[model samples]
Target chain A: MAPMSFAGKTIELDADGNLANRGDWSDDLARELAAQDGIAELTPQHWAVINFMRTVFEKDGDAPSIRRLTKESGVDTKMLYALFPKGPAKRAAKIAGLPKPKGCI
Target chain B: MTQTAEPIQKVSIIVSRGSLEGVYPGLIMANGARMEGIEASLFFTFFGLDAIIKKRMNSLKVATVGNPGMHMPTILGAIPGMSAFATSMMKKEIEKLDIPPIGEFITMIHDAGCEIYACKATVDMFHLKKDDFCEEVDGVISVGQFYEKAAGAQIIFT
Candidate 1:
């Protein structure tokens, strides 16, 4: 695990850079993490996905897969890719402060 | 001897088992590889061909024999309906998580740009036709063709 510095506060990140503790996550943290991943800012659509992912993770105890994301998040597959690029589920989970999504590969 | 490093950009997965648990690991790996921006190809042969056969793909079973996960004595595993019970149990669990059925997963993998190939030798031996396969199957190819296509890619047999 590595430490991420934001607002003079040190936060822990998993080896893959996801938040080490979901309870430590906040909206500002997500914004910082998203920017770290190269996104300039989080848009409303991005918030929709981030919130949806966090909600699902809180209930399911695991991040949702891309299949589940598209089917349940109200965000279609194409837009998901466009919004997150590269790997949507993985990026979204990281930004949402959840564990890496299952079945991402 | 020093080995030169060559970036791996693709993975070739060979699926030769027919059980539900056996078939899924390959799909999971292939899907994972693709998510990492790597190209993935799944070559199905022998009993693995059941994964692409429309009528059988959704009906794959978990083998109780030799499966420590079964948690039952090996002799009891030979009882009829045990496989069906196991399959149904697995299916229910998967469905609860909203995972797509095997057929849909195959299509999803293909749509994700992973090439799905049927082994020609097995196709001939089983007298299977293209129509017998699910739409996700790109084509049937000989072992030589698969070898050529798999050239330079990491090969995994499951």
Candidate 2:
């Protein structure tokens, strides 16, 4: 695990680089995380997914799998990949300050 | 720095059986690979082509007879409509887990950028044309081409 500093506040990250403390997450931190994944800007579609993931995790204590995300996140599978390339579920969860999804699908 | 094992970058899965149990493992593996940021491709051949065929893809049945996993006596398994019954039960369980149906799963994995291919020999033997398959199929390729695509990647046969 490593600590990253943003706006003079130190934030801890898990070994997978996901935010270690969910309470430490902020919109600015999300933008910085997305930028590290090569997304220069977070669009509305990205927030749609991030917001959905956080809402689900808040209620369920686990992030939704990609299949669930596609079905209920108001975003389709193809566009999810386009918006968060190379593993949308894993990437989006990381940016949303949630743990890695556990399901295989 | 500690030395780390090399991650799998790509996988080429070969689906050679048409049974509901046979085809699903390969599909799940291929889809799982793509979800982990690994490249994946599925090559359907022999009876496995039924998984991608337009007319049969959605109607695949579980094999009750001769399948030891069914946990039933062979004679009981041979009873009429047993396979359909088993397949329906299995589909229900899968749906409860929120897994998509086969046809929709194929489209989802393809939409996620996993390549899907049909075996040329199997397609020709079955007299299947390009249009005979679901639109997600990338193309029909020979074993040689499949190997070429499998180069530098792990290959899984199901």
TM-score of each model's chain B:
0.90, 0.96
Q: Which stretches of candidate 1 lie over 4 Å from their true place?
A: A1-12, A20-47, A76-85, A102-105, B1-9, B64-75, B96-98
Tell me how each candidate scores on DockQ against the true complex.
Answer: 0.31, 0.79
lDDT of candidate model 1 versus the reference:
0.85
Model 2, B47-73: lDDT tens digits are: 999999989999999999999999999
TM-score of chain A of each: 0.92, 0.96
The TM-score leader among the candidates is 2
Model 2 per-residue lDDT at A56 = 92
Candidate 1 CAPRI level: acceptable
Given candidate 1, what's the lDDT at residue A81? 64
Return the TM-score for candidate 2, rounded to 2 decimals: 0.95
